[model samples]
Target: MNLIKVKGKSENSFDYIHEKWIFKEIKESNEQKFKCKSYKSKFKCPAILQKISDEYKGDDSLHNHPHPVIRTRMEPVNKMKVPKTTRKITASKRITIKPTVPEKLKEFKNLVTAYQLIKSTFIAQVEADDGSCASILSTKYCFDLLGKAEEIYLHATYKIQLSDIKISQILIFFVRRNNIGIPCVFVLSDSTIKSLYAKIWENLILRIPSIKENLKRVVTDCYLPLTFAILEALPQTDVKGCWMNYIRMAARQWKSCNLVNMRHEVLKWSFLIPSLPPDQFKNAIMEINETIRDKKETYIEPVTEKFMSFIKRWWEPAATIISFSNSTNDSINISEYFDRHMGSEFGSLTPDIFQFSECIKRICDNSENTWKMMERGAQFELYEKQSFIKINNHISNNLELLSDGKISLEEYFKQAMTSDIHELILKILETRQYKNDVGRLDEFHKN
Candidate 1:
């Protein structure tokens, strides 16, 4: 055994010892003595002999001993192993947790009431602070508050019989799912051109900066100028022509071409083309073309050419016709709703350009806020019911297994431990609470 020399001024100092080895420090007079801390343990520790003195006159290398003396103070002389005991746990009766209906109802009611109170308070604060509490908020202001829109629906309400002059109003509705936010309106004295529409859209984007990246889809009623303008402005955005509008346009074209009997059939064919897969769409188009060719009437040539042109221009390259078709009914509903509200508010008098624009803006703001409130309530109700249903169904299944003697209590508990219903419940609660907080803050700032 070779003796290891460690240089240190104090016993507690660990400068010279290897980190892997364990040792104990002992104070003895002026010099310190180091004993192997692991002398009697499982882990191996380096053996260190007595400390060398500077007064030793012999050769230091010869004085160093190979075999190290075990330090008696560091040895575990009274160590003993204790006996271990095992435990057996018997299965207990299953405890069924009944859903507390009244408590849950109370909780939901409290949450909704709190949400409404916060919303109302915040809106009141905003109105009070502004001092100019007008019925109509600016379209740009509403869009800024609502944040970015995923889809933009454009329509022009033309020939509005106003008090002084007849003007065309271009309405641009920002949409996300079934909810429609504030609509930007442009009153045009003359027919709208691509350049004019492009400029309006450019200005609109400047006001709502997020629209540039968030605007993924643009749906319009097949106006060539607007379609071309949007394409030029938003090159990456997918432009879709409304399916209902396309069919209506096709019907008019067919009637104009004197194909009265075939008009309905042609419209049906056009409607079916958008729903077909790419390969099937091509086959259907070919079949339609063949059917049109069979018509011997001299005027049928123009009708066929027009139908083919529509398919190539709009139907074939469309991202989705279903979304536009779905939104068509919604658009009509919104228009009717707006008309009813406007009628009630203004009665028989036709508003002037400024009044008309403000009326539209006011209606849009009220509708948007109303829709948002309804949507939040509906979402909370839906998530709560879904969570309970899932949890109850799982519990019922586990109870059935337990009653059938197929699973032990331990096994059932193991499975129950795996169920993440608590996480879902907590998440739903947190989400609703967070929505209320953020929504109230947004409303408070009039955003």
Candidate 2:
């Protein structure tokens, strides 16, 4: 007899054949059942007996389970039994994965790399000896690179852009005021109000950790929006108007009112205000009021009144906090640097937004480097002075020797000429003269 395995209808059930009988495991019954063509039953049907014993009867009952059908056993047939089989199981494949950096960290690294590249490029251009090369570098190529760098850096660091809706470029400046070095900037945007400025500042503070404690005062052009914004964001910090802008605005107002003669007076007043102590500010205002009262008959009366109103409104309130004696020269310095290195063509032509940003950044970097060099020059100046004093003493001693007849005039003159101090003094004078000429050049460019 051959036993054949057949698939079960359900997962747990299977079928096998033994000669003329077929047996199936009934999942619901939890027992094997058999069906045979010979209804008379050859052997005491082991499948049925097993099912009865397992499902309905006990072990002692099975010994007495020779019912009428099983008592009439005809014969028993011997068949080979097969062992149980199962589906083969295989091991799953292993997967290999490479490590990676977090997205934000990677982005920050990229931004830093881009910033260095942009800064290096600008420094190179600024240092270039060829006028045409420097000009070309600043015009379009450098501008575009700087724009890209700003985009990358600002987005990575602050998640903000200067090109965002209604936003112009952000003007940043670092200034030392009242023993406090504050790094502050203005975000120029469309129709800025106090509330808008406050929101922008809040966002900036949230993103820039350095700004939280370092910012002490804000200096601006007395724009209403900017004034309100600073007041709202940092109520404790002092807000002062740019003295230069104040004077310029006053001059413009004087011209607009047809009181051109008063323009010089306005300029003089602007210069005087910064030098006065806070306590004297009120006295100065009173004096101005008296002057206006005396000139009430002149055509300048209305203009003078307007100017006084401006002073009372903007300047008086800020007198105590105002530390800068002159209007900030940052903008002037940047403009001069650009004009000097880039030429009139680049300066005159209005660059695209990106190009303009690039220009500003390059100017800032160059200005910073210039300031650093000047700081070092100051130290050099001290050393030069010390050397000058020593050399002067030696020269005086030589002169005394020549006068006393202890040394020949020729010998004294030769010793004096041979002294290293002569060369040192010449170098010092030349440097001072060069610096003065440069200052004049800067003033010329500014005008």
Candidate 3:
């Protein structure tokens, strides 16, 4: 059998491609053996290859499928070279060098390699400067800022897109530096294609082992495409939905169902759904649906249907751990950061290519400065971190009370909306006491 060696899903393993049929190494096999790729399919293919001395043998006894067309897997193609920076070369003057296509590509590739070496990141793709598409540029800094971060945030800025330059969006990856979130990676894409995003993220995860191994969580908006892409690439990392996005989606659905009066309740449920224990989440959703149906409004059916549909799409199959549910205010902070810098500095919501480049440089410099500062032992008081921990602990404690049947779901919902959960807990106890006293007085009067 003629076998061609190809890269496997992992670094140590190898797959054999043979005349439209692929074979994967069988881990359980004692000998050097490979099973047909379709062995796990419903067809139950029984083809196998066993290594005999320096040669291999194939058995296609149960093979039934026709030959498949061979397609190349998406691999990182190094397209640019890191440019040699001299004392005379500065950030402003670096982009002015008009060079041949080959030279420009080489220079960019080298720069990307240098950036990857420093930033603890991997450059997935670098589009050539054909003037037809936007190119992703990388910087030359020396630090593993991303590796040290346990969580990262993903966001996109459309305000920097230049229509004339074919720049549709700029995707940014933010990692923490001394508790201060900073942009660790940037990708300038021609369009917001889901597959493109998935491919980029997949390549990044595959190329950088630290990010793949050590990254614990990622925060992103409730955009299904982006969320799915992140999960597809970083399967091990927890994907936390942005709080603002969660409220916006729930509110939008509420408006569509003509249930604006129930907006506060809907928002409260939106926060509560992902916070519930996984075993209780689906039932809670059902209970909420029944409660809405009990409202007896003319549009009650639509309200329940819309709410259920929203729950099915967004909340179902999502992890229900409260600590992983919301990204407190990272989304808003990043948006404000972009607005203050990109809006004021560029003086336009949409900047041209040159202005956008400068803005990216500014962002990179800010991130590098943050990394350096953190390395120098400069500390940033993370109010968000403190709040996150407090809120998580508070919710966990309340959830324990809920699970123990000590607090009713109604009271839980009400307290969930309160800013100070401890104060709400105290108020709940006071209300119960007052009601008990009133009941005793009424009973005594009746006697």
Best by TM-score: 3
lDDT tens per residue, model 1, 1-447: 223345333553542232223345545636555555544443233354345663212121221111232322321333223212211111111111211112211122222233332122121101112221111124444455423567666544432445643333334353544433234332332334555556555655665667778888776655666677678878888876443344444444545555555324444455434423343455556666765677646335666667566566545555344333222222221232232234443332465433444455554555355445444542212212323334444555654575577975434444543326434422432332121221111122221
Q: Residue 355 error for model 2, in Å? A: 2.8
Q: What is the lDDT of residue 102 in candidate 2?
A: 22
Give per-candidate clash totals: 2, 0, 9
Residue 325's lDDT in candidate 2: 24
Assess each prediction's global lDDT (C-alpha) against the native.
0.42, 0.38, 0.55
Estimate, for each residue in 224-310, the C-alpha lDDT of model 3 and write its tens digit: 656677888778988865544454445445555555453345445655665666676677677667666776474357656766776
Per-residue C-alpha lDDT of model 2 across residues 1-447, encoded as one tens digit per residue: 344556444555555544323454444655554433122343223333234534422122211111222122222232122212221121111111112222221122222234433333322111111211110112233222222221111100011233312232233333432111112221323323344445555655554544545565555543555566667776766665433334434444444455545324433454344334465566666766776687677536766777667666656787776523222221111111111223332242334333333555555443333334333431212212333234445555665675577975335445654435434423432332121221111121221
Model 3 CA deviation exceeding 4 Å by range:
1-134, 142-144, 177-179, 202-209, 255-264, 321-348, 382-406, 419-447
User: Candidate 1: minimum summed lDDT over ten consecutive residues — where?
Assistant: 119-128
| Model 1 CA lDDT for position 227 | 70
Ranking by TM-score: 3, 1, 2
Q: What is the C-alpha RMSD of each candidate to the true structure, in Å?
A: 29.6, 36.4, 22.2
Residue 324, candidate 2: C-alpha displacement in angstroms: 6.1
